[model samples]
Every structure is written in structure tokens, then in C-alpha cells.
Target chain A: MILEGLARLGRSGLGTLERLGRAHLLLAGMVLGIGAVLRRPGLLIAQLFNIGVLSMLIIGVSGLFVGMVLGLQGYYVLAQFGAAESLGVMVAASLVRELGPVVTALLVAGRAGSALTAEIGLMKATEQLSGLEMMAVDPVRRILTPRFFGGVLAMPLLAAMFSAVGVLGGYFVGVGLLGVDSGSFWSQMQSKVDFHEDIVNGVIKSVVFGVVVTWIALFQGHDSVPTSEGVSRATTRSVVHAALAVLGLDFVLTALMFGE
Target chain B: MMGMGKQRGIEILVGLFMAVGFVALFFLAMQVSNLSAAVNSDGYQLTARFSNVGSLKARSPVSMAGVRVGRVEAVSFDKDTYEAVVTMRIDAATDTIPDDTFANIFTAGLLGEQYVALEPGGSMEYLRDGDEIAHTQSALILEQMIGQFLFSKAGGD
Candidate 1:
């Protein structure tokens, strides 16, 4: 029984390794597929509409609420120490350093990523990908490249939008509603948050997340069985795996970027 | 899967989305971060040596008459002198500061962050880049002051 358990563990471990290798192969194909997107930019723009514009409302609303909550919580926490004037800096720093990119990536992974996997998996299920291949059109170039680049290009901008909106939300809560001095609120944040250190790093994190999330979504769809149930399973797996990857990579990235 | 007109509409909406995203990035860089508020790029550097910097760090404000004139660019240690060497970047716009200005570290409030305050001196010569301030006062540690107070009380007995 113990030997059987060990064998099962080894089999699962090997299966993970195999999947990792296949994901890298798909990544290479995607990289090579960029030429097709560059040749016809309209395809990429269409995918951008689906991936980015569609995701904006959720990103903006969530960002505003998150920032408002941060402001409210930060004010009360700092008030206990008579440091309420520092609320803007607190809110901006936390949002820029951690929340903005991370939350935006999480939202995109759930919104666009799942949809991407579902769409691609369904295409494969319906033999659409096979049809394109039979016609001598590379599905990876014709279909996958635009969608992948769309996610990659959209991520940093979405993260920036989230952070900007969130900062405004914090300002509204802290200065407009909570009686904090507006000058101190903005000036304090401006003085404390460095553009290169905070803002740029957050953008970098979001871009990395975009690449990773999109890569996972595309690979899962391409690798799924050509059936309805397989497409559904691949869609669910894309989200769960992308979320865990984002959170895990966040810790590693924070350590590298800000760890002293 | 859509007609040409519908496709063009999507392209327009995508263009709008891209424009809005760029605007948001601009807002982050300008208002949320200190990209626009940095000291002038053509600023000159001045150095000062202190016995103790306490919790003073690089990027701390350097002010004259409670108005910020520059920023602390770097904080290093002088191995030979056993002192802290601070490098400051003062805006070229404020080029009239005297050579004999005194640099002193002060806290904002009780248990607040430390900053360097400059007291100008009367001199015909103005400080230039690489010039070192002659007079410097280090940051005051509250615990050391309390310890000295207790020591003085015991000594009085």
C-alpha cells in the first residue's frame, strides 16, 4: 500500500513536469506567432476590445471600492496614533506597492482569461482549429497570437487605471468625506511615493502577470480534449491556476523588487 | 463574426480604451507618484558630515525657513572620520545659499520623521557643487536625552 502511494505521488509529479514542458513549447509557438499579429494589427485590436475594454468596468469599480476601504481603514488606524494626516501616503503606498497590480491581475485572470480559455477550447471542440489547420493556416498564428498580445498589452494599462482610480477613491474618502486636509493628502502622497520605485514596479508586476495569465489560458485551451466537458474543465483550470500563479509570483517579485 | 461597420465600431472603442488607459497612466505618474515633484534635474550637490544621523535617511527633505529647497540624495559613512556623510541635491534655482550655511537635522513632530534644516549665513561666496558645509548638527535621539537627564539627576545626589 505504501509503495502504491509513493508510485502515485511520483506519477503526479512527473505529470506536472510534463505539463510544464508542454507549456514552454506553447510559449515558444506564441513567441514565434507574434509576426502574424504585427502583419495584421487589426486582429490584435479586435482581441484588445474583447480582453481590455470589456474588463474596464469591473477593474474601475473594484479599484474604487478597494481604495475607499483602504482610506477608511487607514484613517482609523493612523488616527489612533494621531497620524491621520499620513493617510494619503499610507493609502497610495499600499495601493501602488501591493494592491493595484495584484488585484487587477486577479480580476483579469478571472474575467478575460477564463473567457479566452473557453473560447479557444470551444473552438477546438467544434473543430474550428482543425479546419484552420487543414486550410494551411496556422491556428497559433491566426488565432492565438492576437489574443495573447492583447492580454499582454492590456495588463499594464489596466493596472495603471486601477491604481489611478483607487488613488482618487482614497482621496474622496480621506479628504472629501473624512475632513482630512486636501493639501496634505495629495502633497503627502506625492512626497512619499517615488515614481520609479512604486509606480514603475507596479506596472512591471502587472505586465509579468499578463504574460503569465495569458500563457496559461492559451496552453490549457490548446491542450484540452476536444469535447464540451473538456472545454469547461480547461476554462475552470485556467482561472484557478492563473490565480495561484499570480499570488505566488507576487511574493517572489516583491522580494526581488522591494526587499532590502 | 460581425460586419465591416460593426468591426470599425469595435476598433473605435478599442482606440478609446487605449486613450483612457494612457490617461490613467499619466495621472498616476503626475499626481499619485512624485515624478513631477522631483527636485530640478540640474541641481547641485552639497555634502555634510554628521556625528549621528539617527533615523535620517536618503530622500529626506532639506528645507530652509520650513520650505523645501532640495533633497538628501545619499547617506554614507566616513570610515576615517567615524561620522555620517550626507549628500544633498539643491535646485539650481536656489543658487544663492551662502557658503557658511549651517546644516541641522530636526524631527517633524514627536516621534516623526527626521529632516535637515538649513540656516543661512552671511557670506559673499556662494556654495557650489561638491562644496561641504562646515557646520553640521546631528539628529537628536530622545532616548539619549532621557538617559542624560537620569544621569545628571544621579550625579546631583
Candidate 2:
């Protein structure tokens, strides 16, 4: 019984290692395929519309709600210390440094990343990828690469919009509703949040997330078995795995960027 | 449903999305953060040495007469003198501060962050890059004040 269990553990460990190696290879291939996709910009533009423009409504709505919640909660907490005037600083700082990129990435993983996986997986199930291969067209270059570039290019923009809307949301709640002085709300935020340190770092985080989330989605879809059940499973796995990867990478990035 | 006109519309929508994204980033960099702050523009460096800095850090405001004139660029320890050497970047426009100006650390509000406040002197020569302020006062520590008070009371008794 002990020997059997040990064998099973070793097999699973090797299986995970194999998956990691395959994912790295896919990443390398995608990097090379970028030139191909760039040669035909229209493909990338179409994917951008599907990935970025479609995701905007959800990102903006969530950002506004999240910011409003932060303002409400921060007011109560800081009011106890008689520092409620720092509401703008608190809201902008938290949104820019932590919530903006991370939340946008999670939402994108759920919204766009899964859709990419499903579409690609369905194409695989229908042998469309093989059909392209038979015609001497590389699916990774013609299809996956464009989608990958779209996600990477779209992520930072979505994160930026989320943060800007979030700050406005906080302003509406803190100044308009909570009676905090309007001048202090904006001035304090301008003084406290450094552009290079906070906003640039947030953009960097979003770009990294875009690369990671889209890569996982593509790899999972490509690796899935060519069946309906397999496509569904790949879609589910892509979301779960991308989310976990994002959260884990976020902790490491935050520690590196913000830790003293 | 996927016609040439629809294709053109999609491309236009994508272009609009990218434009909006750039605007959002501009808003974040320009309005939300301190990108347009005077500290980022051309400046001259000045050094001040304090016996104790006490929570003063890089990027803290360096103000003259309650108006921000520069920012603390770096803080380092001078092992030979056991003092904290602070580097400040004074804005080029505020170049009239005299060489003998006194630099004192002050807290903005109760339990708020500390900043370097400058008191101008009557000296004709102005401070330039690499100039060191002659007079300096360190951050006040509450514990030191209480200790001095107790010692004075014991001496009176």
C-alpha cells in the first residue's frame, strides 16, 4: 500500500512538471509568433475588440462599486481617528497600488480568458486547427498569437480605466455624500500618490497578469482532449488556474514593489 | 451577419477602446498621481546634516515658510559625525534661498508625516547645487521631551 501511494505521488509530480515544461514551450512559440501577427494588424484589431472593448462595461461597473465600498468603509474607520479627510488618499492609494490591477485581472480572467479557452478548445474539437495546418497555415500565428497580443495590450488599459473610474467613485461618495471637503479630496490624493511608484507599478502588474492569464488560457485549450467534455473542462480549468496564478504572482509583485 | 460593414465597425470600436484607454492612463498619471508636481522638474541639490532625523524619509516635502520649495531626495548616515545627511532637490525657480538658511524638521499635523521646513537667513550668497545648509534642527522626539522634563523636575527638588 505504501509503495502504491509513493508511485502515485511521483507520477502526479512528474505530470505537473511536464505541464510546466509544455506551458513554457507554448510561451516561447507565442513570442516568436508575434512578428507574424504584427504583419497583419487587422487580426489583432479584431481580437482586441472581442477581448478589450467587450470587457470594458464589466470592468468599469465593478471598479465603481469597489471604490464606493472602499470610500464608505474607509470613512468609518478613519473617522474614529479623526482622519476622515484622508479619504481620498486612502481610496486612491489602495486602488492604484493593490486593487486596480489585481481586480481587473481577475475579472478579465473570468470574462475574456475563459472565452478564449472555450473558443479555441471548440476549434480544436472540430479539427479546425488541423484544417488550418493542412493548408500550411500555423494556427498559433494566425489565431492564438493575435488573441494573446490582444489580451496583453488590453490589460493595462483596462486597469487604468478601472483606477480612474474608481477614484471618481470615491470622490462621489466621500465628497458628495459623506461631506468630506472636495478640495482636500483631490489635493490630498495628488500629493500622496506618486506617479512613478504607484501608477506605473500598477500598469506593470497588469501587463504581467495579462501575459500570465492569456498564456494559461491558450495552453489549456491547446492541450485539452478533442471532445466536447474536454473543451468544457479546459474552459473551467483555465479560469481556476489563471485566478490562482494571478493571486500568487500578485503577492510576490506587491512584496517586491512596495515592501521596504 | 459578419459583413464588411460590420468588420469596419469592429475596427472602429477597437480604435475607440484604445483611445479611451490612453486617456484613462493620462488621467491617472496627470491628475491622480503627482506627475505634474514641481519636484519632478529641473532642480538644484542641497544637503543638510541632522543629529537625528527621526522618521524623515526620502520624498518628504521640503518647504520654505509653509510653501513647498523642494523634496528630500535621499537620506544617509555620516558615520564620522554620527549625523543623518539629507539630500534635497530644490526647484530651480526657488533659487533665492540664502546659503545660511536653517533647516528644521517639523511634523505637519499631530501624528502626521514629518517634513523639512526652511527658515531663510539674511546672507547675500544663495544656496546652489551641492551647497550644505549651515544650521539644522533635528526632529523632536516625544520621549526625549518627557525625559528632559523629568530631569529638570528632579534638579528643582
Candidate 3:
């Protein structure tokens, strides 16, 4: 029984690896097709609207809450040191450096990622993908390309919104609630945060996460079996995989960005 | 999946969102990396050496009486003395520094950055082009001090 269990473990591990390989191939192709999306700007715009603007309300609301939390936590910690004025610096740096991009990506994956997966999965299950192919349509270019571009374009913007709102939330909590000197909060934040290092690096991280999460969602949907149960399972998998990928990629990017 | 009018609205919304994002980015750059203090200012070079620099880096502020007068241009180790040598670029507008001025490597605030604090000397003549600050003090490393404190406490016990 022990030997059988070991064999089962090895088999499952190999199977998971093989599945990952196929998904990698699919992601590469999906990314390459993004260039073609530019030629069909209308489709790109459509997908951008469907993906980007639709996620704004949730992004803004969550950003405020996250920022407030940071401000509260940072103020309490800093207050013990008698340096509550630096709360702005702490909040801005934390949001711009890490939380803003990562949390935005998580939310985007949960919302738009699942939607993208379900849309594609449903299309696949309904034989619409095959129908498109029968009509001499390159389904990848017609469907997947625009969605990929849209996600990549929207991610940085969403992250920016998150950062901006987070800063405001920090302000409300730190300055308004905690009575940290408003002037020092702003000045200290300005003095400490580097434009290239903090903000731009964050934008870059969000862009990378956006592409990855979108790729995962699309790949899972494309590879799913054509059935109702399969489509729902793919949708769930897309959200979970994209979230994990966002977190994993975030760790690597953080290390690389600040390792110097 | 909507009609033509809705598509136009979505496009408009996307454009507005992108605009807001770019504005936020611009604000971040301007606010965080404030070049207003260092704009178009030609400067003179000055040098100082220290036994320790702590976390001081190039571009660290050189402040005079709580005001930023210049920035550290480069930080290097002297081959012979085995000391940290810091090069500073002082603003041309403020060229009245005396040669006897003491350059102290002190940290700003409790947990803030290490900076060069200039304490002026009582001298008739002003310092000029590529002068070395003869009076220098090294950075106070916190960890070393903490270790010393612990050791002293243990010995006392």
C-alpha cells in the first residue's frame, strides 16, 4: 500500500507538470496574438470596456479600505516610537511598493479573470469556438487576442487607482483620525518615496501580473473539456490559479526590484 | 456585447480611467522625487572621509542648519586609508561655506536617513573649489551600539 501511494504521488506530479507545459505553450501563443489585437482596435476597445471600466467601482472601494488599514496599522506601530508624522511615508511606500499592485491583481483575477474564463469556457462548451473556426475565423485572434491586450492595458491603471485611493485613505486615517501633522505627513512622504523605484516599479509589477493572470484564465478555459461541469470547473480554476500566480510572481518581482 | 452607442460610452469610460491613471503616475513622480529643491543648480565639489557611512548612499542630502544645501555626489572607499570617502556637490547660490566647517555624518530623525550635517566654523575666508572638509565624524551604527549596550549589561550583571 505504501509503494502504491508513492507511485500515485509520482504519477500525479508528472501529470501536473505535463499540464503546466501545455498551458505554457498556450500562454506564449496568446501573448504573441496580442500584437494582432492592435490591428483590430475596435475589438480591443470593446474588451477594454468590458474588462477595465467594469472593474473600477470595486477597485476604488477596496483601495480605500486597504489604504485605511495600512494607515491604522502604521500609525499604531509608529506612535509607539513617537514618530507618528511619518505615517504618510509608511502608507504610500507600502501601497506603491507592494499592496497596491498585488491586491488589485487579486481582485481583478477574482472578478474579470473568472468572467473571462467563463465566457471562453461557455463558448467552448457551446461549440461556438468550433463554429467560429468553421466560418474561417481564427478564433484566437478574434476572441483571445483582444481580451489579453485589454487585461494588460487595464492592470496598471487599476493599480494606479488603488495607490491613489490608498494614499487618500491613509491620509484620512493618519492625519484626520490619528492627528499626525498633515504637513509632515505629506512632506515626509514626498521626501522618502522615489519615483523610479517605488511608483514605476509598481506599475511594471502590475503590468506583468495583469498579463500572467489573463494568460492563466484564457489558457485554463481553452484547455477545459467541452461540458457544463468542465466550464464551471475551469472558471474556478482560473480564479484560483491566477490568484496564486499573482502572489508567486509578486514575490519574485519584489525580490528582484529591491534586491539591489 | 452591446450596441454602437454603448460601445462609444465604454470607450469614453476607458479613456477617462486611463487619464486618471496617468495623472496619478505624474503626481507620484512629482511628489515623491521632488526636483524642485535641486533644479538647474550648478555646484562646487567638496570631500569628506568617514570611518563608517552606515546606510548613507549617493544623493543623500547634505543639510546646513536644518536646510538642504547640497547632495552627496558619490561614495567610495579610500584604497590607502580604508575609510569611506564622500563627495558632495554644494549649490552655487550658497558658496559661503568656511574651510573650517565640520562635516558630521548624523542620522536625521530616529529611524530616518543618514545625512551629512554641516556645522559652520568661525573663519574670515570662504571655502572654494574642491576643498576637503578636514573635520569629519563617522556615522553611529545602531546595531554596534545595541551590541555594546547588551555586553555592558551582561558584564554588570
DockQ values of all predictions: 0.89, 0.89, 0.57
The model with the greatest TM-score is 1
| Residue-by-residue lDDT tens digits, candidate 3, B23-86 | 7666666664444444634788999989988989987889999898888989999989999999
Cα lDDT of candidate 3 equals: 0.88
Candidate 1, RMSD to the unseen true structure: 1.6
Q: Who is ahead in TM-score, 2 or 3?
A: 2
Task: Report the lDDT tens digits of candidate 1 across residue range B1-157.
Answer: 4698899899999999999999998888889888886735579999999999999998899999999999999999999999999999998888988999999999999988999999999998999999999999999999999999999999999
Regions of candidate 1 where Cα sits further than 4 Å from its true position: A1-7
Candidate 2 lDDT over B1-157, as tens digits, reads 6798999999999999999999999998888888888436689999999999989999899999898988998999999999999999999989899988999999989789999999999999999889999899999987898899999999999
Report the Cα lDDT for candidate 2: 0.93
Stronger candidate by lDDT (2 vs 3): 2
Better candidate number, 1 or 3, judged by lDDT: 1
lDDT of 3 by residue, A86-141 (tens): 89989999999899999999999998999999999999999999999999987888
Return whichever of 1 and 3 wins on TM-score.
Answer: 1
True contacts kept of each: 0.87, 0.90, 0.63
Candidate 1 lDDT tens digits, A100-200: 88999999999999999999999999999999999999999999989999999999989888988899999999998999899989888999999999999
Better of 1 and 3 by DockQ: 1
